[model samples]
Target: MSLIKKTFKTIDELKKHLKTHAPTFYYSSQTSTVIPYDKIADFFKNKEMTLGDLSQLPCSMELTPTQNLIVKGAISWKDAKDFLRSKKRNIMTSPTEELALISAGAATSATGERCFHFGNLRSQIISLTYLNFDGNEVKLNQDIALKNTSNEVKKYQKDYAQYDIFKNAPFPRLETQTDLMIGTEGQLGIITEIEIKTTDDFPVNHLFILLPKWEVDSKAHLEIINKVQKFRNMVILCELIDANSFEYLPKADRPNKEMDAIFFEIKTQSFNDFYEQFVLNLEYIDQDHVFELAATKFHNIRASIPRAVFEKNSQMGVVKKGTDVQVSVSQFETLLKIYQNFTKLGIKYNLFGHFGDAHLHFNFMPLPNQVELCHEQLELLYGHVLKLNASPFAEHGIGIIKQKYIPAFWNQNTFKVFKQLKDEHDPYKQFFPQGFMSLEDHS
Candidate 1:
């Protein structure tokens, strides 16, 4: 089987082509996804399907007086950010990948630094237009939620009121049809345009705080984290780098290679008051360790760790294996303990990510022979986290690699709703046929 690549410059052209030859997989910049290359190649190995390149689509943006941004799906986060910056505005939250398209973010329900405050891409989307399975255009927005009169929706609301697909959402909310396209891993449709809410660009300070690993100094480390949490109102982003992950950090940035790090940002509108009260008053926090850098510089240093690990895995011919689990604030410490205890499995690993959201990435760097063992350990870990009521796949939606874990995440009742949604939106199963959930995994 061969994969044919097709590029579409306009929505009309895409819709026309889709009517005759529907694309099975879509590729834009492909810079942000963790889906393995082998998985994709293997998936298309036996099928003849066109791979649509959406990167060439219109990259336009229009900001309304009410701060709503109408953007074409092809625009990248970097371009969108630059456009927003010129207007002295910013999106609520975005992933770190600059080349990754904003539409990909919405499709994957992406989240990043400010997610703990504002929420994921799903929360920012006010409206969207997408091509359905039949090449027919469908538009959905907030207004549709009010006008929804379907019996299926009513039953879904009545039956699954207690269930939440995204467990870490700031608050519980009912699901609407519009929400289906946001995070179904591109299974439902192909998004062409989106309207997202934007916020004012506020000034902030980025700080990297070094602390001894919990195994080395638990009491002192816990105290520092507690102090940082006290100013939750002012702190926007708080991420961690465990001791094992320090090896991935650039040598110049690894001031204390043996110690862990917490990189956070403080809203600087009232910097003087916070500096005097927080930094000056704290004797435990080393003034020397609290280094301030520009937002870009800080993010680069933080991002370098994960990028290095990814490259290293590729070099070693091992598929990337990692967790995107997020638990309740109360269970966060327990999750940390479980991750740290994973070392007993004798597999090398690194842990880092959004500490504020109680979400962290625990990546396993396994040898070729250790891949099976690593997977067995991961299944056990998933089961344990499920017992703790954790979001097995948070922030990042369940792509191909994470599909096998869906059985553990969803029960029979919830699974039925998922299948029903799939049947309604993509009855032919043409879009990313192997992305999120498989038909056989339902039971």
Candidate 2:
């Protein structure tokens, strides 16, 4: 009866357990279907179905003397960071590390925007082990798989090269087969274990800048970002907060009326150089001498904005919907224009995020009755993003919620390739039955 205590070491055992106890369909009391366990039968017929409870798996880490870490997928980010810190090793911070810790067979920080601080989670992965739909385990490493999948890799690149959005955009290099899995969004397989490259622990310098709305126009912000790019190697984090976000902050901590803020974390060694080169007409409302505490405080503030929006909406019986959109650095001004247009329409929204990478999170808070209007606005906004050749789902993976928007990003041919990739790896759609492109869409 206790699912947490159950463990299935072999594929056959797992299959057998599931076939017997797992429900064919499990629905949430409120909205959508919660689980579709019956789909596994599509891949394996009459197998003894055993379901392994991954949550029961212990979190462990193996650290080499050199500081490289091999961590189990179920390990919490905070626990992993604490372990590394105990050994006097560096800890990389992914967005909301505690809440969005890496998932088994699932990738973290898949987008280029959030990874601006730390390298892409995929890039740091030296190797990984995953489970295919048939319950078979497959291990892959960066070097060997690259050579084996060279032709398919080339074709994948060539296909995307034809699209202006992907062709002109500054994409991170995909040097290995492991790299392709970074943004796969759990479609290919479930990642169980990961070997990651580590860095030498270094101190950081945190700085905060508050700019009045009039003074921090698109052109001025772009100029500041261009100057900051010179120290890209040293700059670990760069985030922008809009005026709407101040509602969550303390009255004393808030920026001036009609003003927004930018937070920066750079390696201490480059602090003086950054301070000297980065000249902007903004007020420094606060600066911290203690970098660690300052970075934590700023990160917490950034994390709280969403929760604040949700709580505020709940009290008013409204719902808040948010979208992540990213454009090439060249289209930063265009993206801002879209945001301004939305604001002019008198929509209640919050705009902020990693402007260094031209990724912004736009949240629309609408009453339950106004949900249709909010969605309509989102559709128009996405159309503009598409016109700019920007990605509507930038950092977040296109899970079930975003499935309806896929047609805008992919053509019939491109979508066909996506279906082929999914079918080849998971023909029965046993894993994450609703994520990425849906089975119904592929059919």
Local distance difference test scores for all models: 0.73, 0.58
Cα lDDT tens digits for candidate 2, 1-443? 22122454444554453344332111111111112233333433354332344543455798977677887646655666678877777555455425444553234234332356664565567777766666566787877545544454456566555333431221212446565455565556656677776666677777766655512465546665555656678788777777887777777765435467677878899888777656332233233311233766776777777557756766765444676777777777777777777666556777777767667777776767767777787788778877866767655555444566556655454455556666677676554444554434442
Every candidate's CA RMSD? 3.0, 6.3
The prediction achieving the highest lDDT against the true structure is: 1
What is the TM-score (0 to 1) of candidate 2?
0.78
Q: Tens-digit lDDT track for model 1 on 10-39?
A: 888778876664547876777644577545
Worst 10 residues of 1 by lDDT: 165-174
State model 2's lDDT.
Answer: 0.58
The number of residue pairs in model 2 that clash at the backbone is 14
